[model samples]
Structures are given as C-alpha cells and as structure tokens.
Target: MIKSKKLMYQIIAVISLGLAIFGVITPGFPATEFVLLCAWSSAKGSPKIHHFLHANRFTGPVLNDWRNGKVISLNNKIFSSISMLLCVCFLFYSGLNIYFIGFGLFGISISFIWVWSRPSHV
Candidate 1:
C-alpha cells in the first residue's frame, strides 16, 4: 500500500511539474502555484524528485524563499495582482451571469489581498 501510494504521488508530482513547465511558456497560466504543488507531491512520493526540484537552478531559490520565509517577490506580487485584475475585468465584461461575475470578483479580490500581504522577498 505504501509503495502504491508513493507511486501515485510520484505520478502526480510529475504531471504537476509538466504543467508548471508548460505554464512557463503559456500566458494566463500560473507556474508558481503548480511548481509549489509539484514540490509538495514530490516530497511525499520521492525524495530524489523533491531534491532535484529544490536544487534546480531556476526553481530552487523560489522554493527556498517560499519555504523558509513565506515571501513573495514584489515583481511576482505585481504580476499576480494584475493578472487577477485582468481576469476579473474579463469576467465582468464577458456576459457571464451576475452571480458568476460577483463570485469571480470576490475570489480575485481575496487572492489579490493575500498576495500583497505576503512579505516581499526583495
């Protein structure tokens, strides 16, 4: 059971990592969240995979900063906030149901607030 569970986790980690990598080149997809999810699943499934991600040149520092300090860089904060705002704007203008628009706005507002509340990594 343990082995099977580990395998499942490894699979999830790989899939999330792939999506995160794809997000790097695809606009409107957030890579950081996927990368964090990958890290978490890898840690549960395979220490080797976790170490690789944690030691990777591009991802290592980000993971370390988030893990150690719960810090988000100013640039990231700005980008996230802008993205959320844009999404809210698009939803509002897309002729969606009023309830859906309201929910989207509420969620985006909450996310924006949370992102700004984090310590800036500088």
Candidate 2:
C-alpha cells in the first residue's frame, strides 16, 4: 500500500516538475506552486529530484525540514511577510480592489500562520 502511494507521488512529482519548468515561459502559469508541489512529491517518495532539490543551498534546508515533518521556518515567515506587505500595497495602489480582496488576504495570512506555526527540527 505504501509502495503504491509512493508511486502515485512519483507520478505527480514528475507532472508537477514538468509544469514547473514549463511555467517558466508561460504567461499564465505559476512556477512556484508547481515547484513546491514537485518538492513535496519528491520529499515524500525519495526521488532523485528530491536529492537535487535538497542539494540546493537555498531550498534544501526548507524542503528537508518539511520532509522531516517540521512546519515552518524564519525564512518562510520573512518571505510571507514581505509577500503580504507587497500584495497589500499593490491592492491599495492599483484600485482594482473588491470586497473579497480581504478574503484573499485572510487566506494568505492563514497559510503563513499554518506553515510557520509548527516548529521544525531542521
């Protein structure tokens, strides 16, 4: 059963890995999401791509920490903080805002909290 699950993860990882790369040149694609998904899959399945990701000095610690069941880190928190600030500033300046924009903000805050709330051994 575990093996089957790992295989599923591997397939998904490959697809996400492809999408991540493709997103680099695609206007409507979000490269980060796919890359994160690929990282998740590789971490869970022990794939070669996981090793590649882990070998990166920047991304390795975070991915490895996630694989080890740690939730968040200072780096992610700072990134999220900066993102939130930028998004809020953009919303204020662009005037393309709507009532539901708060919901989006709320969601971002929630994700930040959820990911960073737990302590990691890494």
Q: Which candidate is the best by lDDT?
A: 1
Q: Give the Å shift of residue 36 in candidate 2.
A: 5.0
Quick one: how many clashes does candidate 1 have?
0
RMSD of each: 2.4, 5.0
Candidate 2 minimal-lDDT segment of 10 residues: 24-33
Clashing pairs in 2: none
lDDT of 1 by residue, 9-120 (tens): 9999999999988877754456777888899999999898899999899889878879988887787777776667667768877999999888877776776777788898
True-vs-predicted CA distance for residue 68, candidate 2, Å: 3.3
* Cand. 2 TM to true fold: 0.61
Model 1's lDDT to the true fold?
A: 0.82
Q: Which ranges in model 1 have alpha carbons more than 4 Å from their true place?
A: 18-29
TM-score (all chains, Cα) for each model = 0.79, 0.61
The residue pairs in collision within model 1 are none
What Cα-based lDDT does every candidate model obtain? Answer: 0.82, 0.69
